[model samples]
Target chain A: MNPIAQYPFEISVEKVLKSSMVADPLTLLDCSPLTDGAAAIILAREDIAKKYTDTPVYLTGSGQASDTLALHDRSSLTGVLAAKIASEKAYKMAGVTAKDIPVAEVHDCFSIAELMAIEDIGFVSKGEGGKFVQDGQTKIGGKVAVNTSGGLKACGHPVGATGIKQAAEIVIQLRGDAGKRQVDGAEIGLTHNVGGSGATCVVNIFRR
Target chain B: MHKTSVPGVWRRFKNRYQIVGTQCETCKTNFYPPRELCPKCRRGGKISEKKFAGLGKIVTYTRVHAAPAGYEKQVPYAVAIVQLEEGPMLTTQIVDYNTDELKIGQSVRATFRKMYEDGDEGIIHYGTKFTPIRES
Candidate 1:
């Protein structure tokens, strides 16, 4: 299947042939480019926000964790342990299972990075992220829309600005304001952000 | 880190290869590269010998075709974290294979390689790096 055609919006793979070669099965284009951008969100008590906008998303939960930065230092390569901790916390706080999230925005610094992220966040089982994406289960109308924002691959990775960008994208999805990238009736959404090779991971949940 | 570095520190260790860091006795947290104090706890940390284990795995990695000026000659090199079995991960270059052969969970070991020497000062920089553990 054409992975690009799986999206509800126009998204393209931006591959930058030159950069540092950090690992194998990965390329500069597959990684998030160092960038500069900003993302913001407006949240209030559900009742209070509803009074003004009639469409206020709920910030149900948030979690963050850190791990060793040395990639080889880890005991496993299947997925990030930091992400698992963050997701576990976020899911517990939101009182929603990973299966409840219909759409999500995850930090995909590299193409392989994205594959691991979806599994870490509970969207799919371990080692199956690559296949899940290749199967188009991550498209807008598929099992769950993943990274409709073009992700860090196509969009850009503005370090400090990405966390907020994830939140803002979730808000857009929850409010049905995502225009071309809208995920049908997305009621619950999630965002995952990582710093420096999954050494740090932040997971957040939002509900409409 | 230029703007953040002290004036003479770089010159003091100009010719030597060493990693300075603080250790927290309370938590036994060893920070490499370096840090001011133990971040896990609010207590002050003690300075100590922090040589790291030079072996680990290629949990994940990437290749860069573009890099900083000093690293231009090393463009298209692999950079990754080698998680030493003893604990702690080190960021360094992974060498000796086609980029396509790099795989997650691959075993690796660390080595020291000369990163280019300074032109005028001739200050040579040696840092820890990784080489793939060739399978038998």
Candidate 2:
């Protein structure tokens, strides 16, 4: 779905199977490679933003939560507790639910992480993320377009820059600046970013 | 780590060698990697040292062929997140096991073993690792 290949290039599924294992159930293909890259965003006050542009995307609501740094310290492994907490707070503050979002950018450091994030952020039922994607619900024209920016896997994971990168992508989507990857009539967008084994998570909701 | 500093290991040696953790008297909850203060019961919880039975069940596992720096030679080693019977989970490598039989929910018990060496001629790190329980 991604047109531009940055640091990590596209590989066939067969090649993924042949790749060396990084951890059980996860091959190198399942993980995003580190890249030397950076991203930036411009946040302005309402008055300043209006001076800059007539159709400014408004920063609606945001929420953050933290969990244990070690997976051993976590009680649940099925989904990220931090992400769930943060997304709930954000959605409540924004007065929006997952159903209201048209486009979303989520952290997908690993392939499984994408699905897990989708579920945690309330994009789908707790255990229905896999079926949602399988049914093409995450595609550009589906129920909710997820990772319209190709995620960390295809866009290249620049580590510290990923949070800002996610927000920037959502901004682009909301502003209708995304070229071919744009979601049609996207009035509301959301971004989910996780840090350090779910130790920290921040979910921000944006609207045009 | 490939070139792990010496004192860094020594500082946490006691915690590493033993399955010692903290238990909250107020909440009746256990914490591995012991915590002095209880987050849930900040002022009321009485923290006490607890030694686990080292018995656990496999929650999930993975085999690492691309080992980290110091463990490069230990290629294709098995690792797992074992949920301790005491209500804590640990990320540890598994040893002395049949690869084909390693499945989720399989019973395991912690055993003291060599974790890894820093490098050739470097100190060998000893700690707890899980092994498939003989009877289970």
lDDT scores of the candidates, listed in order:
0.75, 0.86
What's chain A's TM-score in each predicted model? 0.86, 0.94
lDDT tens per residue, model 2, A1-208: 4454364355788887777778767888779888777888879999999988887888788999999888867878889999999999999999999899989988989988999999999888888989999899998999999988888887878899988888888888887888888899999999999899789999999999
Best by TM-score: 2
- Predicted candidate 1 versus true structure: per-residue lDDT over A93-184, tens digit per residue: 99998899998889887787788898988888888898898899998888989987778766667888888888888888898888878998
Off by over 4 Å in 2: A1-11, B1-13
Off by over 4 Å in 1: A1-23, B1-64, B78-113, B128-136
* Residue B58 Cα positional deviation in candidate 2, in Å, after optimal superposition: 1.6
TM-score of predicted model 1? 0.71
Clashing pairs in 2: A24-B62, A24-B63
Tell me the tens digit of each residue's lDDT in model 2 across B1-136: 4897776867565668888898999998898878899899999999998988889999988888887788887788888889889997889998889976588998998888888886778788788998998763
Chain B TM-score in each of the candidates: 0.69, 0.86
Error of 2 at A105 (Å): 0.7
